[model samples]
Target: MSKQVVFHIGGWSSCGFYSKASNVLASLSILFPSRLKVVDHKYGSRDEYRSWLIGTSGSGFRDTFGISKASNQTSSPFAWIESSDGGNSFVGGCDDTLAWCKDFCAPKEEGGEEKAVHVDDGHTKGHGYDYDLVVIGGGSGGMAASKEAAKFGAKVAVLDFVKPSPAGSTWGLGGTCVNVGCIPKKLMHNAALIGEILSSDTEPFGFTAPQALEKGHSWEKMREAVQNHIRGLNFNYRVTLREKEVTYLNKLGKFVDAHTLSLTDKKGKVSQITSSRFIIATGGRPSPLNCEGGELAISSDDIFSLEQNPGKTLCVGASYIALECAGFLAGIGVDTEVAVRSILLRGFDREIADKIGAHMEDHGVKFRKGVVPAKLEKNGEGKIEVTFSDGTKDVYDTVFAAIGRSADTGKLGVENINLKVNERNGKIPTKFEQTSVPNVYAIGDVMEGCPELTPVAIQAGRHLARRLFDGSTTPMDYKNICTTVFTPMEFGTVGYNEEDAKEKFGCGSYEVYHSSFNPLEWSLSEHRGKHPAFAKVIVNKDTDAVLGIHYLGPHAGEVTQGFGVAMKKGVTYNDLLDTVGIHPTSAEVLTDLTVSKSSGKSADAKGC
Candidate 1:
């Protein structure tokens, strides 16, 4: 007698996985060797099948056929585990079944099975390295990429340098963002911003104290505390990585072949690993300015370790980093001067960036616009003389070089592989985190597209994990990615800029809505100037659809995130109107704008 097997392509909500299984079964028939008949569940009603899978949300698959449980049976709360290998193996049902039974799984003594697997798109690929996945640079992208692939039953291994950062004695499993780069920097930025608020706002608000606000906090102590928090997170990340059963190599990894890697530990020991797929997320480092006497300048990495603040500082570059450092110095009563070759913060909203420059100047930051640093020379008096392209020179105590960062792909043997890196800016070329080689992927600053923000890196890493390991083949859409700067008053933006929209869609087709106001928090302050918040929306005049949203204010980053989500979901101006505003909140200003009623421009008088 031929054995008959029925394939049920029910609405299991596994996103067509059951249909995929049916296709797999059809393919398996030719290879099964044994004679078997397959039945389709076409005749069963959808309601009946759903009821079968979720009868009580408890015992969804109790022996409806009156079969008794074996004396030595392992009981799992899943709907059923109908293994092709019979009672020798067990496979849990759909995600709903797992969710239903998750909390009820019994103790080890009662012979209960382990918790059912989630089987999301992130776990589509089977675990292990015999499978096609290879993850390079065990930072955020690498760890997440490898772990997700491993969960999908794909063989995954991460090659990363476990070399400790000078910022901390040890490294975390999550990589740069969590360990040394963004996370630590952001924490310091937060602390510094608070210090600025106390200094700039407290006295004006009639909140006097015996001690000066600047003396109320120590930058060194804050740095140590922030470092401690980062170290703790690193430890927790290691524990989580171990629980996920990921293969982590404590060595420097480089591309050896299209699907192979060479890992070298600090001890000069080397090991080789191969995989069918690979990912490159090594990220980037601060670029060297290469000016004469450049060694006298300090990069962003040294800022956290500064034992004493520079009494007078000249910051080079109009980049966000440079502006930020200048702002911090100005806040702390330093004679700060920011010099830029041309426009400050190129690629940023020109008007807003200029206004910010004006604000900086108002707060005592001198702007040396359209000036090039020819060279730097340290005099005997411990003052640094910086000469400009026009043969002019002035002296300051310190110089900060904040030009930009470059992709860290060159030394990683990426050139040896099939990967084609773009020569324009020397970044690994990728289409939505995919590299030249099909198996190898790239994300973060190591590759290009979108702003080089930590959140962008995390998103790319997480999304790649879902697509490769969880069976989600969806590509990440970069549209409406929110971004911010941690300067005095935070700036946040999402979607197209006014110029970008006009360039892409023409100015006649769009309208702008903008507003600036002093926040309620500053009501009691003697500095009655507007709190320096602006909300601008670019919209298609015909459809009333919001093309972009830009905000400058406190918590701008957090507020813009929700707007980013709305833009991603294709939310329109009418949608904005329909949603009830959260009263007395800074975000409500986004909804309060009436484009047709006013000039749709900020009222604050422009000054520089």
Candidate 2:
């Protein structure tokens, strides 16, 4: 409650807008010494401010205020409000900033002294329930919603419990990204990349690796470090909840009724609690392999914390999980193979997925096509003996099942309230995450048809909280959701794929502009694999509207993010050409795309 609010005001020196905005903000900061402070950044020009922001806070600052280096319009200074709680809310450009500061100080500046962000006492009352908001599953979405609701003075409780995997793997809060999915996966993926650099990438750069490379990777050490980092994050989330005054219970919650939930601890002790509203964000677990001796294979839940190096790994399935695991395993000097019964990265752009598969093949990863694991059993040597559907068998020290993920709604007692769950994926069907029961909602992977992404879930949760507590009507936009598959050569994509675009716009309605280029970073490496990285943009010919953007190369996630914002704003193909590109970067290839896939012309890069 004693936390100070900071206004980071960025502007050009000597500009009238900056002077006026500074005066308004200065008045507020001076009046409310304990509550408000202004950090003034004056630059020689608008571009100087842009350069300063980028140099100071990098992408985070640029993204917060939508500071475009490309923008030439010097309309007004940009301002953002940062609370001591580390919550950031944009206050907008000069005009909006002055208006907001005026509103805050007007009450005291005129006659009445009032709090800046005063929440009505009516918003805090629990309406006769034990809590105002009871969030089940202490994952990212639930954590965010609970904390935001608490900001509105609403009482919130978050219950989270990790049921041990079949292999007994369990972790604390922050959900899949922190515990098992993105965090650990990226750590291992980067480790594999480093291993590749040490083994070969160093030669071209005229450097030798440490002698440890000769002995190969130590999976035990990597596992230890990654798990330790994850644990720290988990602890921090717990502390964060405490600091926000949001009650957190390390217990599993099941619906006792529409308004009540049964909390059961690991010891099987049970208690009942009630809330005026509930949000389900239990997330998902890796699906079981579902075959004879399938339990013998480990899931992603066990891979991160594995006690021993997974030697000669056979990753079964074609999901990103499967390919990523295989990529890292092979990169670290372990023999790795992926078994596929169908296409790779289903629901993603198939061309990009096939390219990823080929890139993996060019590396050390092998593929066993047209075969699913029919059986998994221990051989005489105590290794996993995997029998394929084709009756072929292979033995391995470990087997990983990355078939898919199933939502954790089965045990939540959704049936008790007649909440409909998509029987196929066990995901709840919701209208903007609201279930059939008006009081209950769902987010994250558990929501039917929702993008199964952590950030999406987090945004949905925070936006839902604003709607519920602050009376906002902004719905979560699900279109053009950007995603990346972190294989050896990562694939980042947003909007529709080629096939999907064709399906939506008819075959002749849309045009595909694609290019293949060797990233300058890879040009020096002699071992730059078989295929050059690729980029493609699908545009509607009728309106020149950019329908989709896809890229495969290094740091694909970083490259796709800015394009995602553009896609959200309905950026057109002509818009891409009009934008100047930062040269020699992989992202620039997108802006320079000229070859049409329909033209039957070579999409390969023209000579430099």
Candidate 3:
């Protein structure tokens, strides 16, 4: 029996028809026999083509292709090819066309056999998995990956569950940054800044009111406002997932096998899903010190939601979290003290860290350096009595522990699949986010050696999705990432620090150009001598390329972000010098930097 084949070349614009139709027709001829009766229908526009393809144009070939009519001959099958009239003529007749098409469509994986090689949606004609991608942990990374995959027509699902903190603090959909970490921290930091402005800067700025002269900040009001904003963000994330057609479940996922997961919800209801691929982005949580009465001390997770103001607070550890909490506490008129086990910002440059510490000290925040908390005990007056390893003790109304964070990988069932994680820290080790198990991948803070930042995770996640669904091979670049510490004076940095550059390239291999300048906005304030803004540019002595950049001043984050782009482009000190300086701005210090460390000249800035 002869088969009816229809080639409807419709909607091909002038340019597209010439470029694509010849190759497509070549593939079609190779797949079918010459006995087939082939009919070609050409149309100029997409609307006209759609009408004919749907049989509204009264094209008889639509009936042959089984559009509205059925064929009595079960043995004969029909096929359709849609195209447009391009200027190019048909290149070959039947046999030559068949041979060329066969070779072109041959599977590269197998030896010249035509097989479906799916690239976009993870499904290949015949597959057994229920979903194309299943992402565990609906944090920033997981959500990004899920949404990106869905955009390519893949069936994606995300499972997320937030286990409460030790202090019973819990949050919703948008993960740590939105629920507890960055969002709340920045809001509280801004609140403290507002308090400082009202108490100190308002008078200098020529704005003053009787009520604005009050010394205290309303902790209750600030907490409520921040929490309300966080709640709205959480809801928006849910709405986004729904709009993207990515299934979101409030369930905890545990690996049952390479392609299977057992999901358990809050009420103990359990379900299972199987996918061709999986992503783990569970992220991390704050860790408390292991000491007596340590449970009494709260971590950052609980601080933002505190019911009342933390008065006379003692922050333990030298991590950025500790310094930030101490800075804001002091800024808000609270008596804040920091207890450091060793150096501040351990992996950061000592010079910059010391400057930050000195600035904090000048701002009324005290530091008890070189002391580790040996024990903590409650005093009779409901204060925390902390004992140091050096046999000294002090009391404070509240103690905050910001020692470090641990990745949330304990309950992920990595052991079931022999997925290796760091023995010391529960961080999943992966190469390009692919775990030891072929189908399993990891991203975000849970991955070993990955940066514990939100944007880093989001970028990695989106990149991974593109690699899987869009046939992209570019990996996430982790170098020269700019980060900001929201201390009272703020610290923003990109690329390597001075010490790191020296260690990597040998001492005296680089030249450091630095300046101490007063931000124009600070002219009216008392921060001139005590908290002068500083900028440092580290350049390779041999190449003259800018290796690193650091800034300390108001809105340091805003200033450093621009320099970060320049550093990524390998902007050199000469390039910076050639760039025009924006007058009266702290960031322009980079362009105007003149004093080198070797010069031994004073780097302090004078009046404009």
lDDT of 2 by residue, 243-358 (tens): 99999998989998888899899999999998988999999999999889999989999998999998889999998889988998888888999999989998899998989998
User: Candidate 1 lDDT, tens digit per residue, 80-157?
Assistant: 324465532223334433332222221111212222122221222343445466677767766766776667666656
Count of clashes, each model: 25, 0, 3
Segments in model 3 whose C-alpha atoms lie over 4 Å from true places: 1-125
TM-score of each: 0.73, 0.79, 0.79
Candidate that would win on TM-score: 2
Worst 10 residues of 1 by lDDT: 103-112
lDDT tens digits by residue: candidate 3, 497-531:
98889887799889999998888877788854676
Look at candidate 3 and tell me the lDDT of residue 435.
Answer: 75
| Worst 10 contiguous positions by lDDT, candidate 2 | 107-116
Q: Indicate the residue-level lDDT of 279 in model 2.
A: 92
What CA root-mean-square deviation does each model show from the true structure? 14.2, 14.5, 16.2
Q: So what's the TM-score on candidate 1?
A: 0.73
